[model samples]
Target: MNLHSAAPRSDDRDGYLVSRRQAWFAFAMTFALMLFDYIDRQVIVSLFPHLKAAWGLSDMQLGSLVSIISIVVAAGGLPVALMADRVSRVKSIFVMATVWSLATISCMFARNFGQLFAARAIVGLGETGYGSVGGALIASLFPKRLRTTLLGAFFAAASLGSVLGVMLGGVVAAHWGWKAAFGVVGVPGLLLAFLYLLVPDYKTVELAPRVGHARHSVRSFARQIVSTLAGSPTVWWTCLGAALQLVVVSMIWSWLPSYFHRYHGAASDHAGMLAAVIVLCGAVGSVIWGVIADRLAVRRPRNKLVMMAILCTATLLVFVTAFGCTMSANLQFLLIALGGFLMMCTVAPTATVVLNVIHPGVRSTGAAILALFQNLFGLAVGPFVGGLLSDAFGLQVALAVMPAFGLFAALCFLLATRTYESELAKVEHIRLDVATSSTSPMTVSA
Candidate 1:
């Protein structure tokens, strides 16, 4: 029997009418949450110079905190991601939001490395839920045409968060004290925690008919992940590319403030403002790139991923010039902003390409694995690696190293081109086949 709400004719209560405005509002709300999520992650970076002085942190000690925070995300993300697939996304995001917010504010209580490390670890744990579920919900809510554009718009929230975190962290650290930086950036997240409730829960088709069952088990979830990776070359390549991207992205987060202060003689606030400008440029770049990718992909199927490769290469070149070569401080900021813009342009395309190639059932899991690599390797090691290099060489030399990493990311995406094109073709073919099968059926009589 046809339910009245889902009745054959109307696009209403039974049928689930989703307007473009609703889709965008959802994107904006989640985008704001994601913005804060990132603020908590990198707020420490802007505070790093001060935090180091106050906490008596050696480069190695500071590196350890960054490393452990990323490592925990790497180690814990998959397990938690698996859990996300099996639970209420709403509950997971809510709980994770609370955990990270509290953990962030708890930084105010840290008088030692152990306290800070523990707080960072908890923040990582909370981030796992946010990153995994947020993308999945966005994908399910938007139509195919709008998915990448919307995701790009949402992902730009990271830049906004980055801007706020760095600028605020610096301002707060300089004026109030480093501890207050944590509290100021962190406390707002608690308020956003309640906003998570207003967003609609994403609807998904169960893998098997529910049959009144408990959700997926650890063993089963593991199998699904294995199967997903095994079946998906796009996942593999995207992960590889994202890992490299993370390294550079991570390096910037972990070290740029220090670089500016040490080299350009900028104060904390000035350095933080520069970082914020770069991130703000990144936010704008991401939205523009999404629009470009969407418009181009409509004609050329592989344009989205191709654009990612090209932009990464361009970013690598600009970043090398910005950091590796000598220029006036103003010129340096302008070049760096351009690089940030190019690098950020890839986020939407990167996410869109990954989403397009995966089965819907495991989108969260796939996104989880992507996050796992990003945090585990890219974010996990980026800051520490930059620091370690800074300790070994000079800060200038350490700052110069990440462009090479960006180059590597460009290569990974370029290498994956054949696989990406093939898989996307398959996805499109399957979609066309399904549409054809549905429309061409039921010739009943002779």
Candidate 2:
């Protein structure tokens, strides 16, 4: 009998079996840091009125402040994730969290546009790798069945963090000042960075040492990244689709408060509160869709991608009506809230698709690549383009036109469905082959 066909030993099984308590603890801490990461990144949205009043800045300039961070994030995410893969995800996260928190605090000291913009760029630099690495870390701790649900819940923190950032920024700036809003939101991240150090992390299974080469060489690492990307169509399509959908999401989050203030006759804080409610609806939607996607995946693996396509198509319709139609403020807000919910349905499933297709060794880098696309095409372009349009015509016109990108997103997802199942099968086959190979003894020929 070949040793290669033998079942995995008990110790091998034990290696993968982390305690449930430890796993949940890591998830909670990582989720909290993700929360703070966005709180610092997004608090500026709530301070828009104060910044505009103080600096006498135009909408384009204000939008650039938000877009610049995403630009930096897109540029920096890949390199940072590659470094994290080489060094250590947990350590990388701790350092990243500390840097961004400090940068957020530094924003309070800025006396001019250049200084504040530079500070925000630093915040982006620190934040770029956290999501990718954090997702990989969480994936390692849990079984595949739970991936979409956990990742969906994990990303939902962004919505919650954004809500608190905008709401708290408005409330705090109303009382103390906009600078105080920066300082208050910045402090918790510092504490969380240290707290994160205490969480246990599992090494990625595929990256662990094997017989042929105990450690990966620089060339091998480069090759792995290329192969990971080249081998997966799901990765490419999901990234593009998510990026397109995010255009709508970014426009709403970045400009909705301003839209309400300018068009709905609401105060800054009140508008922020209203926008926060809309974003909170997105948070709810992410969790709901995540659960739905998980169930769908079990029932029919291809259904997750189909669901994403459908959701994106639905988002286009609802947001177009919300923005395009003439309606009361209450009615508009409700429709926009519904659009927000539908917009986020793609989040968990996209992340799930990438993780499902890519090898575990390069999972973080794959996520970083997705981040690069999503940020570059979606986060970076959405707000800036919206600002330019708002300048040329009006904010409402800009928003009304942006939802059309969802049609492109939906098309990409539908295309992805064609190849997703086949790609998934390839991954499973490779995994089984690897398992069989790892159990076998090598033979040397003279």
Candidate 3:
């Protein structure tokens, strides 16, 4: 039987054309795991004060703890994602989740900075591949038109998870202890890892038969990665643009609770709750911006990248005002929330652009590459730089200045507009060729 006959058509016009029940199930599970992923990652930030006092740590040391995980993730993401593309995404995710969850649990037993840092690095190992693979899975399960909205909502899970992680970490640490907070948050992910095994997944594009020797698969895989990266300039621009925009996001999420505590004279839990509210606004903004971007794409197909540029521009302006001005704390809080909303608007649209331009054969790898840039530039550097600035100039000054990086991000997106349509057309042509080839009968080897 021809595999193309079994595969779902991309052009089916009836609304909700994908496998509705199974896709939603997979999405829910994937989204839940993403939520936990951030929860485990961000919970440490909420405990910074406690850890500082107990360990006699400096601001830079606290920041390094957060940045180290991203450093590891950025380094490991591409290789692990390539492995997922060649092997099984489902099994890969299961192993990844279990490893991270166990790593999170190990944090509770850490006796010092070295132990804790090593445990966090292990957490990074488990998380590095999950996002790219999950994005590919979700992209495959849904129609192309809904890509932005679906992925926007999917990525928004990070914000929602961060909110819960910070909020709960503060509350738990205040009452029980910082170590207990790690255990409480880490256990649920273990349960979710088990449940995730039941979610449906499609075979990767590389699994489709090609006119190539099995022994040459490794070389072929590396060639595909190189070709995908070289052919799609949009991927390069989008990744860099998203990374630049995320500098503001990483700084805010990493340091906002501390800002509330030191600047506003709020308690640890109070600061965390307030920061979580701001983060929640970003979550809502992601979904709203996704819908708006989709509507704009419908009206003007060329405006997708343009919309991202506009959003990043707005993010730069809003965040700078929110942080740079010395308004009443109430007004600052409101402006910060507003800035978060605008900042988050870039997430879904950028992801949609990446998916649109990359070949399905390397979608996970493409996403992994994007993750590498975003994490390396944004997650790994943003907080550490902010902390260094904080130590030198003060926390408020550091944060106030960070939003300006979004300007560079906006420029990257604007540059991407030039090549977006051309790259998208190329991907569409590749898909058509693949479909045509898939429909042909297989020939027996002589």
Instruction: Please provide, for model 2 over 1-446, each residue's C-alpha lDDT reduced to its tens digit, 9 standing for 90 to 100.
Output: 12232354443322323557767888999999999988998899988889999999888888888898889989999988888775677778999999999999999999989999999999998898888889877876676778899999999999999999999999999999999999999999999998887666544445333577577777876886797778788889989999999998989899998998899888999989999999999999999999899999997788998998889899999988988999887888889999999999888889889988887667788899888888889988888899899999999999999989998999998889888888886554222111112211321111
Stretches of model 3 off by over 4 angstroms after superposition: 1-18, 207-209, 212-217, 429-446
**Per-residue accuracy of model 1 over 1-446 as CA lDDT, tens digit each:** 11211224322222222445655665777887899998988788887788677777877677666667677767777667556665556557777788889999998889887888898888877777567578877876666777788888888888788888888889988888888888987888888887766555443434333436677776875676577667877777778787788787767766777788888888988998877888888889989999999998888767676778888888888888888898887898889878878877667777777777765556677787777777786777778887888888977787677668777777777766767767765443211000011221211111
Give the clash count for model 2: 0
Candidates 1 and 2 compared by lDDT, better number: 2
> Which parts of model 2 have CA positions greater than 4 angstroms off?
1-17, 204-216, 429-446
User: When superposed on Cα atoms, how far off is each prediction in RMSD?
Assistant: 7.1, 5.7, 4.8
Model 3, range 298-407, lDDT digits (tens) per residue?
Answer: 87655877887888888878777887877887788888988988888778888888878887777888888889888999888888999999999999999889988988
Model 3 / residue 378 / CA error / Å:
0.8
The local lDDT score (0 to 100) that residue 195 gets in candidate 3 is 85
Ranked candidates, highest lDDT first: 2, 3, 1
lDDT of each: 0.73, 0.84, 0.83
What TM-score would you give candidate 1 relative to the actual structure? 0.87
Q: What local lDDT score does residue 66 receive in model 2, on the 0 to 100 scale?
A: 87
* TM-score against truth, every candidate: 0.87, 0.92, 0.92
Model 3 TM-score?
Answer: 0.92
How many clashes show up per model? Answer: 1, 0, 0
- Residue 301 displacement (Å), model 3: 3.4
Candidate 1: stretches off by over 4 Å = 1-22, 208-225, 425-446
